[model samples]
Target: MTRRLLVSYLTLAALVLLCLELPLGYVYSRAERERATNAAHEEAEAIAGYASLTLAYQHPDELSAQVTACAERIGGRVLVVDPAGALLATSHPLDAADQAALADRPEIAAALRGGNGADVRTSSIGGVNWLSVAVPVRHGATLQGAVRLIVPTGAIADDVHQVWLGLALGGAGVLVAVGTVAATLARWIGRPIRELERAARTLAGGSLTTPASVTTGPPEVRVLAATFNRTAALLEHLLASQSAFAGEASHQLKTPLAALRLRLDNLEPDVPPHLRGHLDAAMTETDRLARMVESLLALARMEETALTPEPVDLDRAAKDRVHAWGALYERHGVRLLLLGAPVGRALAVPGAVEQILDNLLSNSLRVAPAGSTVTVFRRLSGISAELHVADQGPGMTAEQRRRAFDRFWRAPDAPKGGTGLGLSLVQRLTLASGGEAVLLEAPGGGLEAVIRLQTLTPRHPGGFPLPLPRRRPMAGSKAGAGVGAG
Candidate 1:
């Protein structure tokens, strides 16, 4: 921002300098050239008067000597010609071809015709630029001869160049001054805003105490800082209140629910056989209510916590969870398998991968039928590591999948004991770790829950890594055969 501001100031300064100095330079150059032309013309006219007297008296020697001295004084060449356009004397001697060409020259011809002539042109001989002036000699209305003076234009060009150089130097100096001022101004304006930005990030990162400085920048920025502080304080207060309410509610509800379950169990022994069904139904309802309360509390806790992401070995986590859930799957007569090879580490919030996997596996186990396979796998997709838990159970439709992450939302045909908060928890944990969770249709008919998390290296989409050649037995479990790499 500072660099941009400085460049903007310099650009504006350069434009202003161009507008002011370009015309000034052009006008000065034209004035200098005009002044030189006029001076040469006046001097040429004076020499023409001397030539008139020299020609009328027929003193060629004196005319030659005078022309030579006049050329030396002015650092130019001088020429005197008769009325018929014949060159009589020259300050500088010329070859036969040059002397022959002088009579037909435009300025000299014009002077012999009783008119003054002046022109600036490039010399055909050496490609040098010259300013030439010619004036006729008159002795009381009788033309005796003409005088022509030629000077190089390099001196005039040198003066104009110096002026342009000075203007450029002045513009450069102005840009430097503007850059320094702009940098100072940018810092003055941007410092408080930067502090405000840092404060905002800190608040988002779960630090509610830090506030932007309100005394440093411009008045508008100070006001913004003050407003940010007020807003942050209010948000912090609101979250604190919410957390307190959740904690208090959890404490107040769990004890009563436990006592109610205990009392229902106590009544089961006293109730007769016919009323036992009614008692059992009551207990079931109570259990479902307790699960709902637990789910709600878990969601509340998750919302209040802000966890930073860290690297975890995705392949190792998947294997560990599959091993843990193997016995449960065997008890239901369903196969739990870990597919794919070992993918590298992925970035996720601490304990987030474990919690997300637990919820997904629980959901899959609930919906999976006897003799059906529940597969867990990890693969690399682009720069993300993907973990998929697929179950051979009834899959949801597009509409159900779209709303699956909503809190307490369940499909119409979902299992009876579900609290409908598992998917929601999975999605929340994934997003908090800067990842994504989605329900995709599994191949050969079922639901596939895919979680994508960040990885340090990029990977191309390809076939899954080769599974292990032999099955490895799980510890303290006879269901090892049901849990092999696919």
Candidate 2:
């Protein structure tokens, strides 16, 4: 992780430097060229002025000598060119090879055309970057001739070169500083996360008591750590609860089972018919207690688990489950009716929605009379899509609805045979999906299980859970053991 951070820092700094360097480099190069040309041009203008004075048609010799001396002070050579392109005088080397090289000078030709000119080229005699400039020399209203000057551009090149070197050194220092800071900051930010990751791994490896080492940082990180620590505490408590429950279950369950065994043992000495029946009932009650413990454990497992949820369409999920159980419903003479069409979308965990529907359907199948209707309907209320399962079986009184979502709750009117864990699982799944589940009496005198959920739609995105009916009255009683909401 540290290595990754370093690489990221380095990559970012390089990209910034590359983005900044090229344009500034071009500007520096251009500025250097301009300065060299301007120096030569300034010298040319002075020499041009001196030549104008020499056009005196008198004292031309004196004027020429003055121009040559002025040119020397600035470390350059001057030339006087006639309008006819003839060189009248020059401070250039007068040797044969040097004079012959003067014919190829572009500045000299430009001055003959009555314009100022400047250029940088390798000098044949000096063997260096030579800056040259030419100016149109005039007298009164008539064009007299032109004066040209040459100076070495090595000084300008040296200054620009030094500037470029300084830029290189400065950029290198800045990049290093930036890289150091970036590395430090990335580590500072990433450290707590790394610590948290290690803590989580320890927990995953079955060390739930492992303490998080992240003491402090930003507020958000500290909050996250606090949450982690609290969750760990809760998990430890739950595990302790499970352990305690296991021991209690063993102790409590053995008594009923032992009694049933004793009752059977006594059956060997010519037991009466009624005595046999009582023994059978005792054994049945023991079996029911065992089944209840098992169902309670299943509910506890579902309650303790945390699973990642994905988007699911509750309507589609209900339809598929109903169809799967349709044949069974028909075989039992219960008419399964899907009353309202599915709304096509809901955001829920895939299997969780199906599980919720299964719980509702199972309850409906249990208490529903032969030839009665078990109806499933979808309704849009506010922003929520609701699935309502109504059965013609006896409806719960308001008191029963209030306690219906509680674990191990079996309504008074429900049959006595079922181990109630289905509704508890439904409640857990509803909370997991950011939704709500409730058991209420349908308008048509049967149990109605309503599940409200937020919708996920392209055109209409989501909805809010509305206020449910709060006050519940007492439940009614019935005969025969039936499946009730847990």
Candidate 3:
């Protein structure tokens, strides 16, 4: 922006200088040429007067001396011709042929015909540019001879060239001055805009304390800064209030819910046999309500917190989680397999990969049937490291998948006891880590929860040794519970 502004200022200034200086230069050049022409005519007339007197007295020597003096004074050639256009006296020597050519010249012929003549042209013999002036010598209406003076135009051109140079130098000096002022003005305008951009990024990064400077730059920018400050302050206040409310609500509700569950459990022993089912149903509802409260609080905290990403070993995290959930899957008569080649480290918020994997595995386990396999694996896809948890279970339709990330939204046929916030939490956590969570159709007809994180290059070569190769199924087991290369 600063560079653009400076260029604009320089362009305008250059155009203005051209518009004002071009015509001025042209006029000065014409005036100098006209002044030179008039001075040459005056000198020719004076020499003609002297030539008239000398010619009447028939003194050729006197005329030659006068022509030489005039030539020295004006730095030009001078010639005196008789009325018949024959050269009589000249300051510069001329051969017979040159003298004949000069006498036949148009200006000299015009002067011998009792008329003054002047012309600026290039000489055909030497190819030199000259301004020629001719004045006739008269002794009381009787023409005696003609005087012609020839001046080189190079001197007049030199003067005009100097004027153009001066104009160019003046224009260059003006541009320098304009550029200096433009640079200062550009910085004045651009600095505030840059500050506003930085402040916006900081706000987006979850810092609401810093505000744009509202006192610099133009009034428009200052107003914009002030508006940004007001908006940021309001947002900061609202988020603070929301965090306070979520914290207070969590504290206020946890104890009452716990007491209610305890009360229902106490009534279990005293309740009659037929009412026992009702008591159990009441306890189940209470537990579901507690889960909902916890889910809500977790979501609120996830939204309010900003986490920076760090490198974590993808293969290690996936294998550890699979090993931890092995017992639970075994109890359900299901196999939990960690498949696919080991992808390297990935960038994710601290502890976020674990949470994301936990939620996905928990959801998969809830719907995975007996004798089925719940597979957790990691693979490298382009620049991303993808962690996938695929379950051999009843998967959601496309529409359900699309809405799954909405807070507390659930499929119509979803299993009971779900808070419907797992996917939402997974998505939030994934995004906070500069990654993404997606629900994809598994290859073998099940829902695959995929978490994609930025791949991180290992700091040192051979940092973590590769995991062991695929292992065979344990003896007497219906399904294998082991890691394998895909």
Candidate 4:
């Protein structure tokens, strides 16, 4: 059993043994039978020579006596019969059972028909196997009676036995030895691989420790170990550097942000209205900077928190947004068309669905032309929900569209401009909440923005939870204005 486990090596060794031994065994078996038949023919020819002239005139009994003597010398028996099929052998007394073996045998019939013959077959008497060889005793090629020799099958059997034993014993021993060596080698190779597996898994689990050394193995394993160690150290160093930078950035930014806020507070009420608006714009920029720095600080202190996500119904959130913005849409003389709602709930951070709609609504309200159609479509199919926010306004040119969602870009033709972060912030929130926002050209003209999100159902278990929508600039836009399709 211990040896059998070495199939990795034993399989090859056994195949080699089979390849070498089978043909030799076949050839050796054939030669054994041929040699025996050749010896029988030679002995029969010698006896015929001895009695060639004398047995020609002698009675059949004397001929049988001489032929029997020749066969017995070779550990076999002999038979003689006339052309009339009358048996006349007495040298070895023939039994009634032996008559049947001689009659049906092809070798016997050949000799009777004036031809030499030989065959090896199992014996019927006592079931001992035998080979029969027949030779014609001829006088000038005239039909003389035949001498048939019956040799027991012991010679060929012995040859087969010896050869088979040698092959089996030798083949088995070689296989066993080869198997033992191969198993040892396989284990030696596997040990390092097993160690590498453990080390790799450890690194994946966020360890900065050095990997297990690739000792006593192939050159590849050694090189891989060195590379792994270097990469882990590099990542650790980079993370530490980012932590220090975030700390310095927050301190540096706070002062400028505070000064900008203080400058806004000190604005004199006596200042002209146009100058006051400029001062307000500067304060907004400062506030945006402070917000960015705060976001960076949060990223630096981030941990792998298991945020369990739950389904959110966008329909309810949209209805609420329409209620909130009903007065505004009315004042703009633009209808809010809330089209078909999707069948399933959307997957979002607690208030992400609300926030995303708010941004789309805000952008739509800002750009929508009075008396033009504005459409909001909520669709659900194939385990996902889509929120389409489209408006009939001057469509963005290709170049402008490319930069439409940049942090500070604004369309030159937009009547009511923004700090460009509105759409960008919506994109950021959508991505972090495991959703996507796509902007495309509307059918007639304007923008077709589709928000595809996983629906709240048992479909995705324990996914990320997004932050709730807030009234803040970026956070406020996820809520949509109910721009009805007029």
Error of 2 at 206 (Å): 3.6
Candidate 3 local lDDT, 1-486, one digit each (tens): 788988999999999999999999999999999999999999998998888888888888999999999999899999988887788999999888987787688998888887889999998868878999999899998988789999999989999999999999999999999999999999999999999999999888777566999999999999999999899888888887887787678768888999999999888889999998899888888888887778678767776788788989888888888888899999998899888787889898888888787778778777777787778876676677778787766666776778888877877666666777778878988998898888876655567788888887633243443332233322232121111000
RMSD of 2: 11.8
Q: Report how far off residue 271 is in candidate 2 (Å).
A: 3.9
Candidate 4 lDDT score relative to the true structure: 0.66
> Where is model 1 more than 4 Å wrong at Cα?
57-61, 124-128, 456-486
**lDDT minimum window of 10 residues, candidate 1:** 477-486
Please write out the lDDT profile of model 1 over residues 1-486, one tens digit for every residue: 667767787888889999999999999999999999998998898888888888888899999999999999888899988888777989998888877777688998898888889999898868888899999889889988789999888889999999999999988888888888888998998899889989999998766566999999999999999999999999988887887787678768888999999999989889999999999989988987787777668767876777788998888888889999999999998899988766788899888888888888888887777877788877776778888888777777777788888877777777766777778878888998899998877766677788999887646556343332233222232111110000
lDDT of candidates 1 onward, in order: 0.82, 0.72, 0.82, 0.66
| Better-scoring candidate (TM-score), 1 or 2 | 1
lDDT of 4 by residue, 1-486 (tens): 234445656777788889998988888888887887788889877765555565677765667667667766778887765554456564577677766566455766787687878876776679888877777667887756566777788767987899889888888888778877878866666666666777777766555464667575567767776777787777657766776687677778888788878867777566698798877777667766775666455444432222334677778877788677767988998777776633467677666667667767777887776776667776664556677777766556666666666755667656433445556656665665678877776666667677877775524344433221111122112222112111
Per-candidate alpha-carbon RMSD to the true structure: 5.6, 11.8, 6.2, 8.4
Best by TM-score: 1
lDDT of 3 at 74: 93
Instruction: State the lDDT at 397 in candidate 1.
Output: 75
Which residue runs of candidate 2 sit more than 4 Å off their true CA positions?
1-28, 55-77, 93-106, 120-130, 152-154, 213-215, 268-270, 273-486
Candidate 2 residue 402 C-alpha distance from true site, Å: 31
Q: Clashes in each model (backbone N, CA, C under 3 Å)?
A: 0, 7, 0, 23
Error of 4 at 232 (Å): 3.9
